[model samples]
Target: MIAIRSSVAQLALLFLAAAGNGALFVIILRLRFVMEQHLKWLEQTYPAGHVSARGEQWYNRPFLVRSLFQFMLFLAAFLSLILLIATAWTHRGEVFGTMPQDPALTYYEEHAARLADGYETLSLETAHPALLKLIDEHFEGETLAILDVGAGTGRDASWFAAHGHRIVAVEPSEAMQTIGKHLHPSPDIEWRLDSLPELADTSASGETFDLIVLSAVWMHVKPDDRQQALETLVSLLKPGGRIYLTLRIGPSEPERGIYRVSEEALNTQLAELSLEAKKLDEQSDLLGRSNIHWVSIGICAATD
Candidate 1:
């Protein structure tokens, strides 16, 4: 859904860029042709060895020099335009910000039913032991407020709600949220249609939480938007609150709009926010794929 829109937008931009460049190239060639025709007329009107009133030869040298300079200037401009396009393309995520639609949301919308069942089958104890341990250690015996971003099917949200926590489950995909609501009809868990790098609705509610969970969700965010996303998440946290993230590490599924997650980049962003993160645990892929893995991280907020 969202992915298709993003692709179309990108294609449109590419087409416009190519068309503009082509038009510019044609105009330059036309100008060159006119200049050549004018020069030819001047040459025929004035003999080769004719000198101007300033005592300079009228034909060969001056014409060649001027033509060479124009050619060089056009060539430089063309090359510079190419370079500029390349740079913009490389940083398109930053330049364009969030896409009109997110591919990951589309994937979830398409696979909501199957994903809900599969997610329900996985045991939380096995799937997220490290996060559970950190939660117990930091927030044990307390009925804390929790924000579960990307809470597809409400699996984690249900678990937290059952454990005496108030939960706000934010899922952007309407399909996923529908299935999630049907599966886990809990009074303690509040569901909202929202998404990351913004979470505009959640932010607008003026709610703060003790714990924010992003389970298998960060990789879907573009690198350029991660900083803003992190800041938004931090803003939703209460003083001394913590954020728990499970980062998927491996080759990305471009079809699913997954990007490679970088721990170093996450750490850098944390530092910029005056926060500190610690590695909670690292584990092989639970789905038994040989090439994939997960790293769990915990970021604690300063209690000033």
Candidate 2:
């Protein structure tokens, strides 16, 4: 089927991209080593009088050989990047830029009041007990830099900020961000317009956080973007910092209109992202949605 082919193509392109980036990084390190070696060779030959007349002539000859070597190194890196771009072009259907805006954004924008009414009280107090326990055990007395992705109406971010943690709340929907700003007017919470797969502004800041929370947000990310979103979140974490994720299970609701996510898939992706799981718990929906289940996972970067 065409769908199956497209999936395969997308996966292949992802692999190519990973390999190309790795190759480029290795080549750059090698390039640096080559430069050091060339400089050392020049010093030994020109100043140390270690060469015969013919050898000195060769050593002092035009810098064409070094230039050629440098050119070849750059050419290899260029070719690998070109290959990555070509692979991306061939699988453009799943490209993040080409995907449509998440329907959940529209849903939340249209029904912000309904969502707020139903979930406003849901914060660290009402969170899954296991996750709360983990938070208490690990971050007992430390003030943290917290990142709340898809921080709907600033419910959780408000709690963290109130508890003396600095917070960055990211929400792409203007409606939700506006409501959050109005509802939770806290100087500790910095509001930013950003979203997953790439948190451009956050990434640009070059600051990592001590805690990152994604409460019922990952499902909005498409399957192709899941890995990248995880990677981005992990990159934003300081070493030994934790990420608490709450995944809503079961079918996608017509109102939410987001992709379905599985616990198995999440664990697999977390392993691929090199995150170490501290705890994982499945619980019935606390909001009295009978049709819904939740998976709460606590994970962190491995520390030596």
Candidate 3:
């Protein structure tokens, strides 16, 4: 998503620069033609060596100088166009992806405080009972390492930390991270600025976890990218480690970058990753929105 935004912004600037230069090139050429015509009139109408004719000659720059200036403008315009083409080509995948901007990121950035507050109002037990139950069944009596992707406001991370599990909380929104850190100051929870489809920093840290939580985050990923996203998640899991994911099953909210999610599609992705679903359950939306529901999935890798 960040790549998409950067590519789009670069393309827009290059386009504007190219257009501006092209417009200036046309304007200068027309102005030069008019000035040359006026100078010819001065030369024909005035006597040789007259002040008006001499002044016209001075105003009329040498042909080489005029051409050089025009050539520079043309070159600038041409180069801008070339650069625009090159950049667009280089980032074609990102620029032409399902979305130009991450609507979810935009919404979270704009409404971080409100959303964080609302999220905080819902207890983890109330919001993710199925996931918590699955976790208890799989990881009871163990203090496990956990990774919480899209750990907004650190609600779930804090919960895991409170239960004696160490957590790495990955959140892309700076505003949300700030509020989350302030709200949940547990030393067991390590906060990171990262996103899915590529958990760059988290992946680079060479850390594998016993559990990876993707609570209500997968829907924001484009369908084409979900496979890769699942791959990345699996890579971060230790052998036999589980992934507790909650799919938001509802209408597509294009404005918020939400997409349709289904258990079938998720199962396909899990199968491709050689993961087995340990728990699959559906629940009503915690907030009680009629059009929205949730699917909780717990998948585990083969033991080493």
The Cα local distance difference test for each model comes to: 0.83, 0.78, 0.86
Q: lDDT at 158 for candidate 1? A: 89
lDDT (10s digit) by residue, model 2, range 98-131: 7563567767867788788777866667675765
Models 1 onward score TM values of: 0.67, 0.65, 0.67
**Residue-wise lDDT of candidate 3 within 75-105, one digit each (tens)?**
9999999999999986675688644557788
Ranking by lDDT: 3, 1, 2
List, residue by residue over 1-304, the lDDT tens digit for candidate 1.
3544554566566656656655666676688789778767876888675434332565556556556655665565566567567756743553466546467877887788888888888877888998789888988888899999999989888899888999999998889999989989999999998888999999999999999999999999988899999999999999878899999999999778799987898898889988898999999987788889999999976443
Best by lDDT: 3
| Local distance difference test, candidate 2 | 0.78
* Distance from true location, Cα of 67 in model 2, Å: 79
Give me the runs in candidate 1 sitting further than 4 Å from their true place. Answer: 1-99, 302-304
Clashing pairs in 3: none
